[model samples]
Target: MRSIIRILGVARDLWPTYAAIVVASLAVAGTGLLTPFIVKAATDHVVDLTQGNASGIATVVWLAAALLAADLANTVLTNVSGYLGDTMAARLRATLSSRYYAKLLALPQRYYDHELTGTVINRLSRSITSVTGFVNMFANSFFQMILTVVAVLAITAYYSWPLAVLLAVIYPVFLWLTTITSARWQVLEAEKNQDLDVAGGRFAEVIGQIRVVKSFVQERRELEVFDDRYRRTVRTTRTQSRYWHTMDATRRGALNVIFFGIFAIIFVQTARGVFTIGVMVLLIQLVTMARQPVFMMSMVVDSGQRAIAGSRDWFAVMAELGERDELPAPVPPTGRATSAPVEVAFDHVSFGYGDDDAVLRDVSFTIRPGERVALVGESGGGKSTLVSLLLRLYSPDQGQIRIDGTDVASLPLEELRGGIGVVFQEAALFSGTIRENIAYGAPDATPEAVVEAARSAGAHEFVSRIPAGYDAEIGERGLKLSGGQKQRIAVARAMLKGAPVLVLDEATSALDSRSERLVQAGLDRLMAGRTTLIIAHRLSTISSVDRIITLRDGRVDEIGTPDELAASGGIYAELLALQASATTRDLKRLRQFDIRV
Candidate 1:
């Protein structure tokens, strides 16, 4: 009931439409009361005509006309109710979608790590559809049923109190049946929802790794796994259906048996002269009208339970997410023209996705206004974590990160992020036109400026080769493009933003030799006169930087010029020797392959 009320809270803004629906519903249910009156008039007129009375004929015709008019009004109300339901569903979808996107963007990285992309999609689409059904049918139908019962009881009292009491007794039995059925279904639905989440997660995983699945020749195995999941879903759905069907059969049987017994009692009363023919006919009409409302009310109970469960899940997500407590408002950065771009300093900063073990530990570094520094480290050594910290993607637990001597956390997040451009390791691109993807960082950028940025990043050549040129559509995640092509497009996007600080996290890690050279040249031009921080795995990328910072176990193990660090017998020296050895081994393999061919 609380869940229903919470969902009804959405109607506060649409009360006018809701009020119309309510009034129409009451007016429709009120017509049930007139059913007995119409039957009474017709029955009494027949009795009068047998005594040669023509006066009652006119009254009979009037009552018949009244019944027809009431039926017409009921039909109109039904139409109005349906229209209201549709509008309500549409409104809810819009509200939820807006909130879902906002919440998703604000949620911490830890939240996403445990959630599947497909599950999110399912909740937004299918789960919301179920909620809409629960709201429209369960709420309105149940209210109308209550109104009908009250109206019928009042009319039945004037005809026969004993009959009304008998019918009222059946209400508790129906309520008990519905209560049991709904509780059972609620548990089933919760289980079904969890199963759905697992299924969705599996589908998303398979799609994302289709290439790996094919390469490993495990396509058949993956399909078998998916088939098993589908079978489980089918089994659960069948079980639920069987339970619902049984409940339906039981309710219908009970209503039939009880109504038959009531009719028998009323007939005996009429035959014994305890009630008139008019009164008996009126009793039947009253009882008949009550049947539909009762059945509808039971259905409402069932749907309401499911809806509440679904709503609780959504609210749990909302409560867990809460809201990001960011600054309400903040001043923009004014350090661009202050002799230095902005001195970004990290003081003993440490962070991890979760727990006490930090990914970047006691990591202290500083970049002057226009300094170009390179972060070089082995895998899992925390170079990427540093870039993430600088972008404020995650907050450090131990120390502070300052930009221009102001704590990064103190600045408005939007303003802080707006001053920096980062190209991630994966080089993610959306499904859109080349031009749009490049201009994503700066939405209002002019077409000429977008073209210039693309040219500067060396992406314009390949983009021009596409059928639509700049307007060419990129497939999902830019899967249609080569690795180098995607990286170049990402670079173009960052270049177009033209922020004062730039962080490149292995932006060219996936590209081939020729593409890497081309991208490296573009990056060189982009890095000039800017505070640039580079995270690279390849020794070639770090060789030209002014300073190399080596990370080990989330801390800066060494920091010096590239040659100085290479000469020192430390972590940097070992890394250089390893890279040299790997290069030699690669060349040896290539020569051997040539001789064999």
Candidate 2:
């Protein structure tokens, strides 16, 4: 109910429009009610004329004119209300959609970690569709329906309170029956919606990773899983429908019995001359008018239940804690000017992905200003998690990460992230042209700047050979490009960001020797005069780094210059030994590192 109330609060912003809709709806009901009185007068006049005691045909003609006027007013007012309803619905959808989208963007990354992409999208679609429909239907007709029911009851009671009482009883009976069925109906709907969400999520995942599905030859199995979810919904809905319609029939039966009793009295009295035929006719017509609203109440109740469900889902997302950056958005950096290199520090930092098993434990380190450092470790040693903490992708559970002595959490995200550029382990590119992906965050980068960045990353050669060059569209996730090509483009993207600090997460791992050599040369030049953190298992990448930080078992095992770490025989030295080829020069280098023969 509070969710519904909040939706009404949304209407408060456009009160004038909504108020006008209500007024026009009432007017429509008024005109509709007048038709019954007009018919009564015409009937009375016709009776008088047959007895040759009425005024001439002028009376009949005037009655007909009055009836037409009421109908014309009904038509005009109904259309006016309908137009306003449409306008209100459109505006409400826009307001609701904008708020939902803003909430999605502001939500923390952890929220997405457990959710499916399609489930997130499907919730928004279903919620807004049902909510807007409910609002529009309720505004356009429910108010008018209530007015018509009231007018009919008032007019009927004037002639005979008995019929009015029976009519009044009909509504509460119908409402009570709907209430009895509502809880079960809602339960079924929620269960079915869950199944639908899972099915929808799988549908999206399969499409996004179609290559994997096809390569694994599991197309039929995937289809069966999708079908199974929808089938479950079908069975649940079947039970729901049987219960609802059975109750609906029971309500209708009660209504029919009540009306039979009311009609028996009206006709028996009219035949006995207890009332004029015209009054009896009016009573019957009013009863008919009231019946329509009573019938519509059942439909309204069903829609109301569904709307409540959707609103509950919608608000659940809105209530999630979002990233805090109350300050206004910073404009994108427009020029090549960079921040002076700043020292980065991790102070006894520890973190985990939800569970108690910490990925990084008491990890403490410092990168001096403008130093090049490499993190090397065996798999599952927290090398990547450290980088994620540094970028504020995830916060450390125990301690603070700082840039130049200021806590990273206290710095605005834009300022913190804007000063550092990263090329991730995977080249996460969207389906767009080469130019668009290269200049992703900086959409306004000139062609000359984009070309210069591409050339630096050794990507300009292949790009120039393409018929469309920078304009060539890469398929989803850059599928049209080879893995090496994709990696080069990612490097080019980071090159264009040109931040004073750089983080490369195995950026050259996809390239062949020749390509790696070319890209590494470019990276060597980019590292000059900039603070850089490199995460690598390959010995070749760390050879030029000023220092190496090694992680083992979620703790910092070693931190030293390349030669010092090599002679210390730590994790970095172990990795270099494994990547080394079994040649005299390689063995000599390993022996030099003090590794046991």
Candidate 3:
């Protein structure tokens, strides 16, 4: 009940609409009660027809007309309430979805480190569907059931104490039995839902990565895993179903016997001249009315329990900390700030992922304004983590990172991220028009700005060759483009951002030689006059960086100009010697970053 009330609070502005729905449901209940009494009155009037009263015919006719009117009202109000319920449920779904998405966007990157993308998405689907479905049911049927139950109990008790006592006893006992089943049932249901959620999550992931699955020929293995999860659910369902039905059968069986005994009492009393036929008829009708809700009571409890579980999951995510800039909501970037490059400093930073050994221990370095430095290290030596920390993807455990001597923690996330443009090994493009992808955060970017950025990144030629030019729809992640094309578009996007600080994480490492040259040219253009941090392994890519910061076993092993580190025989010289043994390309690409390796 508390969870349901809390859910209602989520859309509290809709309270007036809910109140109107409740009124309509109440009227439906009122009509249901009116018809039963009308039947009783008509039956008694028929009894009077057999006597000396000639007015009984008209009385019966009027009673029948009144019963029809009550039924008509019941139909009309039910339709109106149902329509309201559907619309309210839709509004709630939209409200929940948009808020959930906003929270997801604002969450720290670390939250995604241990969670699957599909699993997070699956949570939203499950939570919204369960909550909205329950809301619809509550407005359409559950409210009416409560009203009907209370009205019938009151009406039944007034005329015949014995039938009322039997009905009252049966109602509570049935309710008690339902409660017991409901408790255990919900516990089992929670477990089943976990299985279902995991299955759903995996299903989406598999579809997204179908190419990987098929290339590895692990289709059979995935199918077996998916099959095994569903098979477990089937076993759980059998146990859950058997228990619920057995209990429900027992409850209904008891109600039926008690109702039969009440029926026997009414017939015996009426035949003995202790009651009238009209009274017996009314008692039967009222009892029948009560039975329907009593039977449906389990379903209501079940739906409520499901909703409670769903709401719990939804609120759990909602309860997590969104990005804490320690300031008011971030103002939007008006336009690119003046590109006066700022010095970036990492001061004695120490950190790791949750419960893991420290990946970076007491590491510190500084990049001067307008200097292009390259970070070089063995794989998993915290090179990527270093850049990530600079991006404020995760906070450092032991030190502050400052840009131009101001602690990054003091800056708004919008400002901190907005000032830095990054291009990674994989060009993570979204499904949208080429122009939209290029101008992602800059909604006000004009077509000319977009084209200029594209031309600067060397994407304009390919984009122009396409039928739709900038209007072309790039499939998910730019799957329609070749590797080089995607990287160029990514460069164009970064160029469009016009950020004063840039980070390049092996931006051309994944491309072929031809593609690498094209992307390298674009990256060179993007890196000019900016404080750039480059993370890469390719000799041609980093040979021109003004300095090299090398890491060994998670500590700063060397930080010097390439020639100085070459003699120092530090990590840089060692990597240079090793990479020098590999394939060679034109020396011209190194001119942009400039190292003497």
Candidate 4:
């Protein structure tokens, strides 16, 4: 009940439409009740015709006309009420969808990592449909049922108060039964929804990783997993359906008995001459009309229960705390001054994921403006975690990170992020044209600037060679392009952003020799005059960096110039020696296959 009220509160702006629907519903009910009275009057006029009264024919014609008019009013009002109900439902859906989308954007990255995409999508879809169903049922069925009962009871009382009193007593009993049964069914329905969510999650996971499944030849295994989940969903749905069917049957039987009782009471009254034949017919029709609302109660209850369940899920997501950025609103940039290199400092920063062991502990470092530094460490040495902290993707557990002598947390999120550009090992591209992807960070970038950035990144030649040049559509995640092409496009995008700080995470680690050379040249151009941090496995890429920071066990083990580190006989020197040995082995293998031309 609280969930229903809260859901309605979301559509408060559409109260006028709801009001109109209520008025129309009452009008529709009023006309329907008048219909039986007109019928009763017409029947009386027919009976009077046996006395040879000519005026009875005219009276019957007038009564017939009134009945037709009442039917016409009922039809028109019913349609109007339906239209209004639909309008309110549409408004409610729009409000909820917008709110849900905003909530998703505001949620932290950690939330997404643990939540299944299919489960979230399914809940959102179901919530929208269920809320709409609830609104429609409330207006057309619930409200109409109330108005219909009241109108029927008032007219029946005019004929026979005792019969009206009896119906009033029976109505509450049916309502109570429906309410209790619906509450129990809701629990089962919720269980069924949970099963469906699990099935949907598995289906989405399998489809998204279809290539991996095929490569591993695990099609049969995946099919079996999906079948198991689907069977569970089916079993739960069947159980809920059976319960609903039994309840519906019981409700109908009870209503049928009450209907017979009302008919019998009218029959006895007429036999005793306590009522005329017209009154008897009228009472019977009214009694029959009253049964319709009671029958409709079951459907209303079912829809209401489903809606409540869906709204609970919807509100649960909305209630979660969103990502908090303490930064203030951004101040407009002053010309050319905003493009200066950014000096970054980490002041004894410490971080951990949950209560697990710290990923970074009391780490302190600084890079002067325009200095190029390389972070070298084995996997799980907290290299990426440091970068993520700098990007404010996750905050440090202790200490402050400052940029250009100002705490990063003091700057607006848009301002801080807008000042830095990144190129990851895997170039993440959306489904769009090459131009759109390049200008994503700077949507309003001029065509000339985009082309210039591409030219600098060494992408213009290849881009021009394509049929549509920069306008060409790149398939999902730019899968249509080769590794080198995707990386160059990513570089071009970063260049177009023209941020003061650049972070390259193993940018050329996966490319062939020819592709790596081309990508390296683009990286050189991109890193020019910018404060750059490079994370790479290949010593060749970082040999000329201003300094090297080697990490061990979440702490900085050594920091020095490449040559300085090599002469010190430390971790950096050992890594260089290992690479040299690998290179010597490769040359020896080449000599084994040599042939003079």
TM-score, one value per model: 0.90, 0.91, 0.94, 0.91
lDDT of 3 by residue, 319-394 (tens): 8897862333543433444578889999999989989999999999999998989887767789889889998899
- Which runs of model 3 end up more than 4 angstroms from their true locations? 50-52, 55-57, 325-337, 583-597
Q: List the residue pairs that clash in candidate 4.
A: none
User: Which regions of candidate 4 deviate over 4 angstroms?
Assistant: 50-58, 324-338, 583-597
* Candidate 4 total steric clashes: 0
How does model 4 fare in lDDT? 0.81
After superposition, which runs of candidate 2 have C-alpha atoms over 4 Å from their true positions?
10-12, 50-66, 325-328, 334-337, 581-597
- Candidate 2 on 453-482: residue-level lDDT in tens? 888899999999999999999999999999
Report the CA-based lDDT of candidate 3 relative to the real structure: 0.82
- The superposed Cα distance between candidate 4 and the true structure at residue 582, in angstroms, equals 2.5
Model 3, position 517, has a per-residue lDDT of: 76
Model 2 clash pairs are: none
Clash-forming residue pairs, model 3: 543-595, 544-593, 544-594, 544-595, 545-593
User: Where's the lowest-lDDT run of ten residues in candidate 2?
Assistant: 588-597
Candidate 2: residue 502 lDDT (0-100): 86
What lDDT tens digits, residue by residue, belong to model 4 across residues 181-294?
877788887887887777677778777777789999999998888788778878877887887788889978987887788899899989999987778878888888888888
Candidates ranked by lDDT, best first? 2, 3, 4, 1
